[model samples]
Target: MAKIPATIVTGFLGAGKTTLIRHMLSNAKGRRIALIINEFGDLGVDGDLLKGCGDATCTDDDIMELSNGCICCTVAEDFVPTMEKLLARDLPPDHIVIETSGLALPQPLVRAFNWPGLSTRVTVDGVVTVVDGKAVSEGRFAVDVAAVDRQRRADENLDHETPLSELFDDQIACADMIVVNKSDLMESEEADHLAAVLKADARRGVQVIRTAMGALPVEILLGQKIGAEADLGARHEVHHHHHHDDDGDHTHEDEHDHDHHHDHDDFESFVVTMGEIADPTAFAERVADTIRQHDILRLKGFAAVTGKPLRLTLQAVGPRIETYFDKPHAGPRETRLVVIGQAGLDRAAISAALTA
Candidate 1:
């Protein structure tokens, strides 16, 4: 029996995992693929986004959503079952992709692949680590960057015993391949410097590839064949993977924590249904400004712009916005915006900005 090939796409927040996945699906050369999306929202909007790609390979059910928590953490809960179902399909997919949460650690998720049922039937093609290049260049990833800029500004680390730098070190240490995304914003020299710094910090010989808008070769992503479970604890150059039974219930208040449920109001998402947007470029600019003014973390949707029959796509991260025509809207021109951020996200404030 030939085992199914699977690739684990793990990265921090806004690392462009979905963008890369979307590219692969659109140019898949007719290979059937299934995605197991561990969405941040209870409503599975990300799952719907992928399925709406208008590709035959992306079916509603084939686009599985594991919102309860990280699929790796709940492998026993649903991960195994989903894999079994995909395997049971009349024509099983050629490959499977698992998009881990931004704050997720690949080591733990990799461990789940070694389970008895999944081990023999499936193989980890590779662990593609997506990184935010502009952030790295701006010193967001390195605490040292913040330290040098504010020498007399009192080290924030003085108040906290442990620093986030340690966490980032572990993420880079465990990667098999590093996809330095969003390189379009950097100069060639800047990109090289970042790459050089990362390669040195990585676990010796980890491949570093620079990409723009998450664009990379499908050959590199599709089939390298690395087993995460078998190679879990050994690959980390700085630290080893921690294996705790974690029987006791514990709550963590961090980006990756999924134990708690978000109410419909924790974040609000809906479509501003109506005629096409008069000027999508201007509308997007205003929305971007609004996100910066407010506390908007993420927003994505499709809009129909006047004069353009195709559905103008809307994807924004923090204040940075990107737009383009995807395909014609199914019906009348309407705009749908999904806003995710801390509580107190004034929906009216955002809605007003769009219509104004």
Candidate 2:
């Protein structure tokens, strides 16, 4: 009974965890893999994204989804049983890749592996922390970290122990390896600066790899014997705890936190469907224009483009829309689009743009 290797990929919102996982699945050398997609949102959108990699090698039953809003709040309730079932399978996967929600914490989830019932057959290959390369270069994680310092004086009970910024630090601290994702989007100098910051701030001595959405050799991410279990003790020592709440109140746990709203950041969403959309480029531009007008967080769905041999898929994260030919539909299914955002969601405006 060989212990199965499990890899955990954790990152903030839009950091490209799904992209890297999809790439790995598509290019894997005939390894039977199982993917567990946990989304911050209530909808199973992230799971669908991984499935769109459109690879036949991955069995349909192998792909599983758990949409419990946020992993931080639901790890015990949702993750435990899920792991039990995965291990209980007679034909368990050779490898298991879990893409946790953007707002997820790696520590608690990793601790579950130590839980009583799961020790014999499973072991963490490693925990990989994914960071947004472009944003890391610009210093989004610590842009105003000291600002948090000053505000703490005003209120003593502030959850100064788990703020999202400090929470991100904890994720990096616990990583067996750090992947600076979206590396192609940054300049060499920018990448170097981010590397320096990461090396200096990392909880333990860890290696940082410059990768395009964590798209490195599968070998690097899998079978990493960083002795994550042994290092877990040291990692906990340097947690640098702060409040997870941005509002300075401990009331961060909310039901809709996973719903595209993400702390009232103003996300908007609308749905549009039709039989055909020939010009994907033109249609994508229209979607972008609509996003520019509103604070759109995510856009998804499939489209049947005319004059094309395959289905033109649509996916947008923030200002970026990644489109490509997935596979052709066997029967007639209209091009359905769902635009989601917290800032600028206008159904009429987006509908006109798509139909225009």
Candidate 3:
């Protein structure tokens, strides 16, 4: 029996993982591909979006979703059984693509392939880590270690490690390849600098590609045949040893920590629905203002623009927002935006601002 190859798509929130996977599924080019979408929130928004692709290669049964928690955290309970079922089917998939939640760690998820049930049956083709170029260029995840160290010393209750920063670093370090997405939102120099930072985090010799809206050639995105499962030991992870409490008391240990746990509750997401906006440019500016005001990590959805043939899709990573006409909607057009941020975001205020 030929072993099926799997590709793990990992990235921070709003980094365009779903879009990239959708593009791949749309242009599968006769390959019978299966997709597993792991969402952090209750709504299967990403999975639903992909299902509407209407691609022959992506049937309803070909797409599976694992919600309620991160895949790495629920590997034994969720991932294993799902993979077993997929492999047991008489018509097994030629290739499998997994779009992990933005907060997930690819290293541990890739390590799950070592399980007895899947070790010989499936191999990880590659680990593609998508990065938000504009966000990185703005130092969203690039915290000053020296400054943080000093702050931690001043306040015993302050945790030295930021979950968002560590999450970004972990994804960067474990990638077999990195995609610096949303490059169009930044200047050429800014994109180049972000790429350099991501490349430094990535494994040596790993390729870094720049794309906007996750547009990359299918051939470049797939068929790497890296077998990341075999090279897991070579990938470096930064959050290996230290585990700190939310209220400070950090520990910097050197133990090879494998039991990684994810706290999804640290992040919060809320949806806003509104009628058509007369001015897309103004509305997008308002949305970006609201995100910056509330310190939102990600905000994405579609809006119905008056006189526009196609629905305007809005995506924001940090304060940088990008809008484009994705496709024509079959039904009535309205604005529906999902805002994700650290806990304690003023949802009511955010909604009011966007609608105002």
lDDT for model 2:
0.64
Backbone clashes under 3 angstroms, per model: 1, 23, 0
Poorest lDDT segment (10 consecutive residues) of candidate 2: 248-257
- Per-residue lDDT of model 1, residues 1-356, tens digit only: 98998888876655677777876777677788889876553346556667878888777766887666555457887888888888888888899998875545666667777888888988887788887788778878522344322321232212122233554566686687787877767898998799889978887546677777665646556765555567876655343322332111101111211223222232344554445678877888888888776656567778877777789888764566778887767865677777755446677777777667
The candidate with the higher TM-score, 1 or 3, is 3
Q: Report every candidate's CA lDDT.
A: 0.66, 0.64, 0.72
TM value for model 1: 0.61
lDDT of 1: 0.66
* TM-score against native, each model: 0.61, 0.60, 0.62
* Angstrom error at residue 311, model 2: 51
Best by TM-score: 3
Cα lDDT of model 3 by residue, 1-356, tens digit = 77898989887655667777776877788999999887643357777778998999989999998864656557788999999999999999999999876555787788889999999999998899987777678877322334334434554333335556776777777787788776767898887787777767677656676776676656557766677888877875677422321122111111111233222333468899998889988888898788767767668889999888799998775566778999997778888998876567898898889898
Query: Best lDDT goes to which candidate?
Result: 3
Residue-wise C-alpha lDDT for candidate 2, range 1-356, written one tens digit per residue: 77787888886655667666766787677787888877543356666656666786466687887765444445567877788788889877888888776555677666667767766667777788888777667767422444434444344533544555666777787786777876667887888688778867875446566665445655445656443554567666234333432212111111101212112122235578777876788888987777666545457778888887788887764446778889987778578888764334567766776678
RMSD of each: 16.6, 16.2, 17.0
Model 1 CA deviation exceeding 4 Å by range: 142-163, 237-356
